[model samples]
Target: MIEKNHIVGKEAQKAYLIGVANRNTPYEKAKEYIEELAFLAETADIRTIRSYIQNLDRPNRATYIGSGKLIEIRTKAEEEGVSVLIFDDELSPMQLRNIEKETNLAVLDRSALILHIFDLHAQTAQARLQVELAQNQYMLPRLTRLWTHLERQRGGTGTRGGAGEKEIETDRRIIRDRIALLKKELEKITRQDEERRKNRGEFVRIALIGYTNVGKSTLMNALTKSDVLVENKLFATLDTTVRKMVIDFTPFLISDTVGFIRKLPHHLVECFKSTLAEAKESDIILHVVDVSHPQFLDQIKVVQDTLKDLKIENKREIIIFNKIDALSADERETLETAWLSKEDAPALFISALKRENIEGFRNMVVDTVRAKHAEKFPNQKLELYS
Candidate 1:
């Protein structure tokens, strides 16, 4: 029996982060990706003792890294007493098995790490059920090997009369049943959301979408003055919150939902489909990007891909470049030049933390929403100035 304390003990959990990229990736970019993996490990409550990055022509089929690198990782892990090895990329099941066999430590990929964080941050019943369903779906494929490993670790006498033997089967059955129940609950919730949307009538709806920890919650609070939870951690807000406000006496609804991350697990997207429906149903999208981050462009692409996956690509969107207060003058100048050079998308730069250019943001959103509304409902004819 694995005690709850075993899972939660800070002293017992030490992690080592690893990142690998092919010759196509620049060394600097690879390093940044590795640092992100470390941030993710920290958010999941795993202590990252070290990080390793390697450039290879291609990942090895068996272990994802070269044999020598694997051996080096094993030696370092043993020396540091690392409990978990976290990879920046998703590993194939065979690669996972190979790494575990070599290192004799718990192994997790970027997807699994994010799921674990979601599991920890989930608070509401809906959010918890969604996370649990996602976790089970992710675990189902690895169950056989995981159970075999568990059996090897926990050798016992026959005094319990095969209770341990049946535990894995019992757990699988429970998880399957729970998954079905959660699906039904989510269906009901979806129907309720549909009705709520219908009742919302002509009010314009906007949603804040962004990379995790890029200050979406802070922007939401600034825009609406609602005290949604704001934190420096990833996945801080799991449940979606919608607030209504009047900008220049024009009523509109804005929603704040869970943030996105690079390579966010497919299971999470599947499970949180209902929550993400808020974005799908919105009239406008406030796509926030952390302007200060070196990987800001990549972050933007991830959010765009996620939005496209959610089938909200056709919706009106304004790129809100956030965290300008943290950017150096040269960096700010570079970003401004980049934005000016781009002619396709509408973009705004602001510091949500300092409340700089918030009024400008609000005005831009109001004007955009009004234009979209007029375009949609030509007969109703709402003027922007009025």
Candidate 2:
């Protein structure tokens, strides 16, 4: 099992972040990637001591970085007393083994770090089961890495296999069995959740979606007056939270699902498919953005790409540019003008934390939800704001 603290004795584990830039990814973009990776490490309670970016045509096949660069990183990490090496991209199984062997330190890729954070933040039974399923699926293919401590004996003419091989096989079997079991359990829970959704029939459903730590939970609290966990950390909300809200005599169901990030683990997405179903079934998608961030546009692209992956990109979307209080008056006005001109979707600028323009935000939601409700259930009689 992965530990949430990832601490050594009484000290928090220090990490060294590594990234590689090729033609597809230039140096500046790679720097932003490293920054995000550092944030992920911070979310996992790991301290980042240093970061290294290697400009290469392609990643090294064996170690993901050149041998000389790896050696340099190892020396600096040892000097800094770093306990872990975190990579910005998902590492192959062979690369993981070779890197660990070369560095003689604990190694983790972006996916594994996100998985650890999810493991830490999971509160409900469904979330726990989903995290466990993702962890098991991620571990199944890396069994050899997990059993590296065991010695692999030379095969004899009469022998079946070595103890390490045997142990790995056994572990793989167990994980596969566990994965099947988890799927069935999740299916059962999903059915129950489906029934609940059905029970809330005729209520307009809206899902809050955005990059991690983009104030989606804060926005949820402002819109629904329900206290969802509002945190500055990544993957803070792993379970889906639903609340009923009435605005101007119009009632609807709103949900806050787990936030998305670049390079999110496919296994995690597969495991949490049921939790994200709220968004898939929503009549309106509230795609939130942190207008204050330097890379808010890239974050929007990441969110949209994720929605495409989930096949929910066709749903009606309302881009809520949040955290406008952090921006200057001119900057906010410029951004609002540019986005509103696009007319791609209904874009609104507001600060959920400061409650700025929240009434305007509410009015927009009511209008959109009422429109969707009437489109879906034209004959239903509900006194809505004209």
Candidate 3:
């Protein structure tokens, strides 16, 4: 098996991204997805030498795309000197194996790409351990041909003859054992987290959650004046950060955690359960949306679905539509009209990047938190001068 140190050098490989869509997926939407995938590949430091799109009713069972398309991609990859192939969708293990056989290039899907980014972004020991656990769980099922080409080229005395084969088998067993041990470590951490949260008492907790690259980190910096690693890349913040903020002498806890994405892997959700508990235990959730994105509505649905999956749907929330400065006049008119027509849930518009309407956004949050606090602690009275 290739050592962990070797994975970094392999990142130098050039990549070609492929996206497939069907009748259910509109052409425009598919194009947007492909563009996003290219950006994601770039963020992972992979040079995109080429890309392909295939319109089909659905993926082929054996190879995802048709074999003919696969052959075309392989030929193009060979001509372009591409060393990696990335898909826009998660592939079944069988499909992954089939594609690897056809392409002769290292293959990865969107989930894998996201995991890789998380692996790189994880900073804290807890975050690192959580990411490693998730990666191990994901790697377990696909270990059969793990770095097969690398092994062949390395050709050490390690894998020569029956002894070599036996050694490989032993290494696989050790990986499996490590997976179990890491899982146990995560369980211990989860328990400790629960206890710590329980001991924090009755302070109102608010969580900022939204789709990746929507300026959640920027908003956090704006609110708390705390420096967090903010970037224009996906999965920039993988670990949870909690800060105490006071609004008009009212103290509340606000947390910024990993942002959600469309089709975020199920395994990741399961693995990041403790990190996400910040949202779960919150008294209010600030669902940040990039108002400037043409598909911001669709992103809202994705975040809502993810929250529902995490069983935090009934929590009180405020819709903070950010990046208002990035919208044009006509687009702003249309979005304002659309937003004004929505009912029930409270909403505010602001430009986190430009600090536009931020004071108004802060007031809205304070009002919501105060209302929730009053309800939760009936004996305490909160006064507002405005």
Higher-lDDT candidate of 1 and 3: 3
* TM-scores for candidates 1 onward, in order: 0.89, 0.93, 0.92
Per-residue lDDT of model 1, residues 1-386, tens digit only: 22122333645478888887767767787888888888877776778888888878887899988879989989988898887888888888788878887887778888878877887788887888788788778776555444344344345343333345376577678768877887888788778888987888677789999999999999999988899999989899999999988777576789999999888898899899888888888889999999888888899999999888878878888899999999888988888887879757888989999999999998998788778777766676454435
Q: What is the lDDT of candidate 2?
A: 0.86
Which stretches of candidate 1 lie above 4 Å from their native place?
Answer: 1-7, 144-171, 378-386
RMSD of candidate 3 to the truth, in angstroms, is 3.0
Clashes of each: 0, 0, 0
Query: For model 2, how does the per-residue alpha-carbon lDDT over 1-386 read when each residue is reduced to its tens digit?
Result: 44444433246688999999988999999999999999988888888998999999999999999989989988988898886889999889899889988887788889988998998899999998999899888888887542342111111232223346776798779889999998899999999999988888688899999999999999999888888999989999998999988888888899999999999999999899999999999989999999888999999999999999999867888899999999999998888788888767778889999999999999999899888988998988667432
* Residues 1-386, model 3: lDDT tens digits: 23332323545668888888778887778888888888787777878877788888898999988999999888988888887888999988899889988888788889878788888788887787788877777766765453555344345443533335555577668778987887889889889999999888667899999999999999999999999879999899998999988889677899999998888988899889899999899989999999887778889999999999989878888899899899887887777778779656778889988999899988888888888888887776555322
Instruction: Give the root-mean-square deviation of each candidate in angstroms.
Output: 3.5, 4.6, 3.0
- Give the poorly placed runs of model 2, Cα more than 4 Å off: 6-9, 146-163, 384-386
The better-scoring model by TM-score among 1 and 2 is: 2
User: Against the true structure, whose TM-score is highest?
Assistant: 2
Question: lDDT of each prediction vs. the true structure?
Answer: 0.81, 0.86, 0.82
Backbone clash pairs for candidate 2 read none
For candidate 1, the TM-score is 0.89
